[model samples]
Every structure is written in C-alpha cells, then in structure tokens.
Target: MSERKYQPTWDSIVTHPTPKWFRDAKFGIYTHWGPYSVPAWGENTTWYSYAMYREADENNNPAYHHHLREYGHPSEHGYTEFLPEFTGEKFDADEWAEIFAGSGAKFAGPCAIHHDGYALWDSKVNHRNSMNFGPGRNFVAEQEKAFRAKGLKFATTFHHAFNWFWFPVWNKEMDCGKPENQGPGKFYPKFHEEHAMPDKEYHEWWLGQTKEIIDQYAPDLIWFDFGVFSLMEKYRKEFMSYYYSKEAEWNKEVIVTFKEIAVGQMLGNKSTQFTFAPGTGIMDYEKGKLNNLTDNMWITDTTIDSRSGWGYVRESGYKSPERLIHNLVDRVSKNGSLLLNVGPRPDGSIPEEAQYCLNEMGKWLE
Candidate 1:
C-alpha cells in the first residue's frame, strides 16, 4: 500500500494526480431522475419547479402556464407536492445498470441530488430524501450496488449545494408563505439579500450531507455542480481533505470533478482560492464539447435528449444514436471523456428513445 498523506491545503491537493481509470474509461452514463423528472418540462435543464414560480407573462412562460393547468398554482400545488406522487413504482436499479453496462459505459450513476434539495439516498442530515419521502428507496445505494455488480465504476453527482439560493422565489408570499405550506422551508430554505452567502448552519448541513454520501456509498467518482464555487473556503477544503483521506484509507484511486467556475479564475483571482487546484481532480464541461484536444484530461457531460434537457419531458426530442456515438469518438480522440445523461420518468422508466440510443451505441462499440 502506498503511504497515505494528503493535507487539506492547495499545495497538498495540487500534487494529487488524475486517476488512471478515468482517463482510460472514456464513456459513462449519468441519470437525472428525481422529483424534477415529475414535472419534466424544462428546455435543457431541470429547473422547471423553480422557474415556474417566477412571475412571468403567461404568453411568454410555458412552464408557468403548464404548471397552472396541470397542477394548479404554485401556492396551492408547490413543488413539494410532487413528493408523494414521485413513488418510483417502476424503478429498477438493476435494470438501469444493465442498460448502462450494455451501452458500453465504463461507469454509471445518478445525480444523487439536484437543486430541488431532494436526496436520492437515505440521508440522515436532510430529512427530505428519496428513502424517507418520495420513493422510499435508497436509490443511490441501489445504483452503486448494481453498477459495481456489473463491473462498472460507480459515481454520484451532487447539485444540492446550490439549493440554498436556487429557490429564492419559494420564500415569497405566493409560494411557501402560507402557514400550512411553510413546511417546505426545510427543503427550499428561505433566503434574503442579507443571507446571500450561506451561513454557518447551512455550510455545516452541506458538509454533513456530503460526508454522509461518502460514508454510505463510497462512490468511485463524486461530481459537483457549478454552485460549489460559492461554498465557504473552509468547508470546501474540509470536503476535499476528507474525501482524499478516505480514498487513501480505502487503498483506491477515486475522482472528484468540478465545473469551470469552481476552478476558473474570477476578477483576476483564482476561484475558490485554488481549493480545487489543478491536477487535484477532473474538470467537467456541462453540455459543452471542447473544440480542440488539450494536454489536461477533461470530461463533457451532455444529454441524449434531442430537446437538450436533462430531465424527463413528455416529448423529449432525443438526438440520433449516430450523433451521440460520433460525439463519443470525437471526445475520445481529444483525450476527453463523455458523460451522457438520461432522464427517467416519474415512474422510473427510462424513455424508449434513450434506450434506442443506448442500444445503438452498444452495437457501434461492438
């Protein structure tokens, strides 16, 4: 076993190299299945719940009108109401893993938590999780087990770090203001201008939820959404240090990925103060493809939905399998990996269009 010594400082983490497996494993699958998939009407993202709450003209806002016609007003039928309806009755982790494995994906997993603040795992820190509230199933653990059983690297994506600020509209009188409906405050936390930056309590909660996931699933790859740059410096350092240390103890080479904002420079200074230093982990481009090859290893995350959305839509315009396969070839030629996303319906069934794409990719690979 190699000596395990990694301090939390940037100087220490910067010395860590990208895992060899990730560099070689050029294809992976990421799923965006959660409460948002219930609504599933966004353009290319899964922010319909939050976007519907915005006060926009009905003529210009389809999401808002759709919400009103289908589920009533946001005040009467808030996003939380979707929880009870999100009973993943058809969810089969083993089957989903088999599809990913058949797709020639070297790794696969779920977006464990999106900006909606609903955790897919059985989380003790946050009460509003899949295990306790929606599906009554530890989806994260199931995927991890199934993926590993299929000899695929297990990964998990976290977007909850931004939930604190993502749903500011929920704090309004028309949303979670009514006495009977104030309960969502636990999930959609009230945010004011003064509370722009998350306070100590929120930071602690973020750290706790992250630690819980790490402890429970031991995901081989942990991916963070863009808002991680807003996290407090100490909390960020603590997470990286703890994750690196834990991987060292397990005698495994794991990966931690972040968006450009988390690692990019801002206003002439380094973002996160180099907390997520270069060479410490992989850099991910969301729904973006690099134009040219680079010396550094990177990954592109795009959706198979021709509509470009990452969640399930009633009519998800799926891209052709040939296009996706060509993208995989292009990415691999440039020393990059592709993390393709598929959104499942509320009942946990993968769309046939997505299945078709995956099957075509499998044939091409063979």
Candidate 2:
C-alpha cells in the first residue's frame, strides 16, 4: 500500500524492527529433505552429493567409496540417478502439518532449498526441483497451506547461498563439469575454475529464487543459512529490502534469520567476513547455545537425530522425549526459540522415533 518502507542499506533495513510474533513464539519446526534423503546415508546426510564425488583418498569420505560400490562411478551415475528414489509416496502434507502442530511448534515449513541446489517448490527460476524431477509435487506450497490451515505460521529456509561452492564445477572427472549437469541437476557455480569470482549471474539467480518465494508464499519467516556471506552486499540488500517492502503490501509481520560467518571466498578482499548487522533480523544459532540470555531475540536450530545427520540417515539416533522437552524449556528460558529439524525418509514418512518424540513433546506442552 505504501512505497517501500525499507531501503537497501544496513541503517534503513535495521530500523524495520523484529516482529512480535517471533518473540512470543518459542518453538518452530522445519524439515530437511531432498534427493539426498534417497540415499539415506552419509554423516551429514544432506551432503551426500558433494561428498560422493570426491576422491576416495580425500580426508575421510565414506560417501565417495560407498558411492563407488553402490552406484558405480560418479562419471556415469551422478546425483541425477538418485532422483527416482525420492518418490514421496507417503507424503501427506496435511498429516505433516498436523504432526508439526502436535509437536507444539508455533511455526513450521520446508527448508525450501539446500546446498545440493534442488528446490522443494514449483520453481520457474530453478527447473531442477521436486515438482519437476522427483515427486512432481510442490513441497513448499503444500507445507505452506497445510501448516497455515493448522493455525501455525508458515516459514521457509534457504541454503542455496552455499550452493555456489557446493559442487566442483571445474572437475572433469565428475558430472559437475558435464553439459547435462549444467542445467539444473548439478549446475553449480564456477567459483573453483577461474576469474568468475563473485558469479554475478548466479548471485542474481539466488535473488530471483528468493523473490519468487516471497511473492508466491508470503511466509512469516525466512531463515537464511550461514552461506549468507557468499550472497554479498548488493544482492543481500536487494532481497531483504524487497522482502520487507512486500511484507507491508501483504499486511504481515515477517522475520528473517541470518547467522555469522568468519570467512568467505570470492570477496574483493578475501579476508572480508560476513555478519548481519544486528537489529535487522533474528540471529540463529546452529547446534549451539548462548551462554547467557540477552536483550535480542534469537533462534537455535538443531536436529532431532542428535547422534546423526540433518537429513535422513540409516543409523540416526534420536533425542529422548524428555530431552527434547527440556531443550524447548531451556531455549524459552534464555529469550530464544528452538527450531528443531527432522529428516524424513525417502518415502516421505517421518521416522517413528522422531514422531514419538514430537508427540511426547506435544503432550508435555499440553
């Protein structure tokens, strides 16, 4: 309704203020699912694509050797081969929303996109996504409507900022360099190759995908990954400015969560680190906690499978229900919210252990 209230500057943007909903909502849930879930392997299970293509001799790449034995060579069977396994056969969005609501989450949604570069929604900017390749369903859209129907705030997290260096685009021994892989399946940024340092075109596409989600979903929160540094100043400012502006038009109070990074590549000064100017948005901690409570609002996102990966792994060990309930209590005590992550099986079913923990937490909260 009004002209863009936020400008693309730290001073202009920080003044927009954090929304009240976030301060009050002490818990949320978001899922980590993709083609990587198909393998249901690897330590950091979501990193299967990246780790599977590296040399066996490289520092402790079990995925590389496992890939060689299970699927053969990466030259032939790249990540594209795993797409069929992600059928999402049992995926019921309404049920998922119910499960999240049952867990007492105030907000919930999909990770949207990860470092592997697959989009969960029906995306025009990125053709390699679940709607087109794997499940032929808009995962993001489904979660948005279902979660909202259950009276939970909708949110989306994007890790595509790290996608720029996710693949070894210059390596000829793998699919990351092939013409076929360049389209959407595995077309990563050419950062390792030559002079294309910042990769302006790729950066713009990053902005494009964010704009797509903001316009399509109008989420209550946007959680950014640590790769925020790679998006650089201009692109970062542009997207935030647009997101804050669109919030006004939608008449919604929204939140954006970003984390700190001490080092980043492709900088004019390579030593330049990326940290979000405080007061602009929520600061999220990854698998860690603040020593003491402070004035600012924050989020702590940790996996449900405490002894394993972020995405589904065959041998994941989960947290006890009491532990999870205590985790929620602790975060709320310290002026923070807990955003718990769950990795569903390839067939789109949340693991029984995770489901049990969630239900127990729901009962505890009730």
Angstrom error of the Cα, residue 284, model 1: value is 1.0
Tell me the spans in candidate 2 whose CA falls farther than 4 Å from its real position. Answer: 56-59, 184-196, 264-273
TM-score of decoy 2: 0.94
Query: In model 1, where do residues sit more than 4 Å from their true spots?
Result: 1-4, 58-60, 169-172, 179-187, 190-195, 262-275
Question: Best TM-score goes to which candidate?
Answer: 2
Q: Each prediction's TM-score against the native?
A: 0.92, 0.94
C-alpha lDDT of residue 72 in model 2:
94
Candidate 1 has which clashing residue pairs, if any? 306-317, 306-318
Model 2 lDDT, residue 320, Cα: 94
